[model samples]
Target: MRKLTLLIPILVIALIGVLSSVFVVDEREKALVLQFGQIKAVKEDPGLSFKIPLIQEVVKYDDRILSLDTETIEVTPSDDRRLVVDAFTRYRISDVVQFRQAVGVGGVRVAEDRLGSILNSQIREVLGADQVTSDTILSEDRRELMNRIRNQARDSARSLGIEVVDVRLKQTNLPEQNLNATFARMRAEREREAADEIARGNEAAQRVRALADRTVVETMSEAEREAQVIRGEADAKRNGIFAEAFGADPEFFAFYRSLQAYEKALQGSNSSMVMTPDSEFFDYLKSDRAAK
Candidate 1:
């Protein structure tokens, strides 16, 4: 009967012990104490804690950094070009008290939503100034844009008692419809340029060929005229030589001239001679034969 009574007291003490305290808090966590469903204290420390077990609840939160990926959204540049952008943000709780007061047991979903809204607004403003992005330009003034976003996020997160570590753009792309149109236009322009180049080349070739033909005709005509002049001069020289020889001795010149004429006029087997009385070819013949 005494042992049973001692056991009852020990059980009561064990139950009290179980209901009155908390285990050691992890070094990487922050805790919030709630009394009867009402928040009473925030504990940002590690190790064992004392609390009313049945009436107090301790909500723990991670003290490490967290990341949130924003949805891909369409943005327009200043030049009226539209593109899809995917972004992400990294943040951490700066004030345990404020996080507890504002977020309660929900952690940072609300906070993340609020930050996403702020980021979206700032991104819209930044992207509005970008019209068409150049393929060669990295991020297209993205550093300046990130700087603007960082400043905005700093101000925003500070107001929410959170610290923004970094925000980054993951991808940027043209919309499917826009890509199709852009590619088609580029193809058409390239084709037009190629055609123009071909036409210019053909024109140039025709000019060169026409000029070559003109040069050929001019050269051939000049050569033929020069040949005719040379031949005429040669004939005149030959005639002059003959005249000089004939004047040097009239009788001998007459005989040589008659032989040359006979050789030319009587070239065929069936031949006849006909001449005037004063003809040089008949000078070698008798005057009676000449008359006949």
Candidate 2:
């Protein structure tokens, strides 16, 4: 019984050692065994684990992708435009050994701080290369331009033992003081363009009116010339006919013309007076009387 009692105490100590050495790996964590403040082994799989009792230490690291939302950063473009840009990055630990060496058990914050610096330089480089004036980055091409900025940042971050999965711009806007200035400039430019268009329209209208006046004057001159020629031809033809008729019989034509004149003059008269009866106008009457 005394030998049994001594064996029981040894078993108890062994059980205590086993309990202290026992460890577990969760689904969201990676286990790193450190001995004497030096990394001994890395365990990635999730399961029960063990370490040297009271001599080694187990540290857990999150292996999942981490998200970092940086604050809105104000930047200036090459074209002298002020802008505020908010951004976010997706990253994960790539080199656990380098990570541990570079930073202690602070998993994502170490990477995040380094990434912020990279993003700052890259954002300046990218937007500095572009030409966005105060307003905003509103188009697809602008978004792509920002993505290229993130790409450069990712490359810079690789040396820090982290891989950038994605980067996105949450918002972009102009500073308070520059907002009204930008709008005013744009409005002035548009108004100037409109005024220029109106001036051009007036010039076009004047040109059209001048062309129409020239065409109308030319057409009217041509019509007047044709009409005068036709009138002259008609007058010449009538003169020729009258001369031939008058040359055919002079006395008969004169007598017939005098009779036509008397007929026309005597029809409108209610009273008539005879002036000596030998008047030349009575020739038609005297000749008629002789004929009777």
Candidate 3:
């Protein structure tokens, strides 16, 4: 019984040592075996790994792609216009050993902080170039600018064991204080355009109205000429008829003319004449044909 008790204690200690020496590295993780705070081995593959009992420790880091949102920053472009910029990056640890060596015990958080600084610096450099303008940053050319930033950051982050996969601008906006001013300027531009259109429309309307007035004047003149011609033709025809009657019978024509004169002189009931009876105006009234 005494020997069994001693064997049981030994077995228990052996079991604890075995359990502490064996470690696991999940498929989504990378591990570093540290002995006395010094890296001894790196485990990148999944399944099982081993470390010394009690003296060695394992530090695991995520192997998947990670994202970091950079702090919002303000930059000035070549045009002297300022913009507020926000961006994000996708990255992964390319060399865990290098990462551990660079970041030490601070781990992924320290690496991220350093990466953020690199991204911001590169962003400021690319955006502040003499040829880059605020319009370019807000336009499709922004994609090209982001690529440049990613390339620069990728090169810079290599010392930190970080591989920058992509970088993209999330927002590019005018500052809050500039929003109202920009809107006012836009409204003024629209108003000016509208005024120009109205002026053009008025000019066209005046031209059309002047043309209509000229057309009316021309039409009226043409109608007046036609009426004058008709009036002259009618007068000539009346005079020709009078001359034919006089040629056919002078005495009868004279009598008809005298009767027309009497009709005019006595057209009204109160019409009166003070002419002498022996006057030629009364010749037809006292002629011999009247007795017959």
lDDT of each: 0.79, 0.81, 0.93
Worst 10 residues of 3 by lDDT: 283-292
Q: Rank the candidates by TM-score, best first.
A: 3, 1, 2
List model 3 lDDT by residue over 203-283, tens digit each. 999999999999999999999999999998998998899899899988889989999998888887787789776688877
Give the per-residue Cα lDDT of candidate 3 at 17: 97
TM-score of decoy 2: 0.67
What's the CA error at residue 46 for candidate 3, in Å?
A: 1.0
- The best-first sequence of candidates by lDDT reads 3, 2, 1
Candidate 2: tens digits of C-alpha lDDT, residues 1-292: 9999999999999999999899999988887899998999888889999999989999887789988887778878766767888888888887777778777766567667878878877877777675654443556677677778778987888777778888888888888788899899999999999999999999999999999999999999999999999999999998887677789977777777888887787875485756765678767567575595
Summarize candidate 1's per-residue lDDT along 1-292 as a digit string, tens digits.
9999999999998887775675567989888788866778878778888777767878877789889898888887765667888889888888877766666666688888888888888777766754435331135677667777767887877877788888887887888999999899999999999999999999999999999999999999999999999999999999898889878987678777778877888887889767676765555577664564
Model 1 ranges with Cα > 4 A deviation? 4-20, 37-41, 45-51, 129-139, 203-292
Worst 10 residues of 1 by lDDT: 129-138
Off by over 4 Å in 2: 1-29, 34-38, 45-48, 52-58, 125-160, 165-172, 251-292
Highest lDDT scorer: 3
Candidate 3 residue pairs in backbone clash: none
